[model samples]
Target: MQRDFCDPLGYMGTRGGDVTATMAIVPRIQQVRDCAAAAGLTIIHTREGHRPDLSDLPENKRLKTARAGAEIGSRGPLGRLLLEPRPGEIVIDKPGTGAFYGTDLHHVLATSGIQNLVLVGVTTGVCVTSTAREASDRGLNVLVISDCCAEPDPLEHEMAIRLLQIEGGYIATIASTVDFVASVNTLAQS
Candidate 1:
């Protein structure tokens, strides 16, 4: 999962001030993180933080992206991990939507022998879906915790989930946070 918090664009409801959408998923994200900790699962956090050089991206895109990040005051508390990752939990700074892009996420996952990834974050149609596609391409089994992901548009969120379900002839599983945590608990017990 990537960029779970921050960025007010997707979090605000129809009423400009309402943040129900973002607030709704915070607990679910916490549940998944807590379950993973209880199960001894390694959790990797990814945040979009472009470099000052802006060499990773084209000039046109770089300018707009940097401005948006700055406008949101991402460098302050908003940019920090909402659920501060515990020590030893890997935190990656990604240049793009997919965690694997412009990062050593692939190498880290491979070296750590992680075959299955559980994706949970904001903007299902964007970052979450992009990461899922990338993970599928890299031969990792992907599971997205639907409830833990939020999109400004309900239909867009559903569409993203459907796309992930059958992408590139590979199937990615979708489950609610409750179900996912239950499965993790079962495995831990067994």
Candidate 2:
């Protein structure tokens, strides 16, 4: 999770939104990450950010974030708001809400022969959902772990999962962190 979204005095906090729910999902996400790593599954991280000159930011999105106190390119306690590629992790920087748009994510997936996608991130209704939808559209089987994602508003977080399921369950399969971890562990043992 980016500091801008998770850190108090950062984006969400500056706009008076409680950061409790967002922070609460961190452990579950880490649990998922560990299981996926042990299973030898690829873990790709997606980050939303604009260029230094804000050239890639759309007018509406810029206005929205500015009003909410997350000025593009602004640094938080965790340093820059975007992302840095960690060793052995693929980091995709996205200009828009979804990761695939204007990014090589699709190409990377195809080249790497990845078919199923598991998503875990902050703001379930936004970047995470957007990425799930995009991946589904591209024929990737998507699974979003319920407890591993959070929104500032819990209702939206819950609703986003339902919305994805309403499309005949083609959008994404929603799971809990416990179930996902068990499945991954079983696969690892096999």
| Overall local distance difference test of candidate 2 | 0.83
lDDT over C-alpha atoms for residue 26 of model 1: 81
Q: Which candidate is the best by lDDT?
A: 2
Cα error, candidate 2, residue 29 (Å): 0.8
TM-score of each: 0.83, 0.91
What is the lDDT of every predicted structure here?
Answer: 0.75, 0.83
Against the true structure, candidate 2 reaches a TM-score of: 0.91
Clashes per prediction?
0, 0
Model 2 worst lDDT run, 10 consecutive residues: 76-85
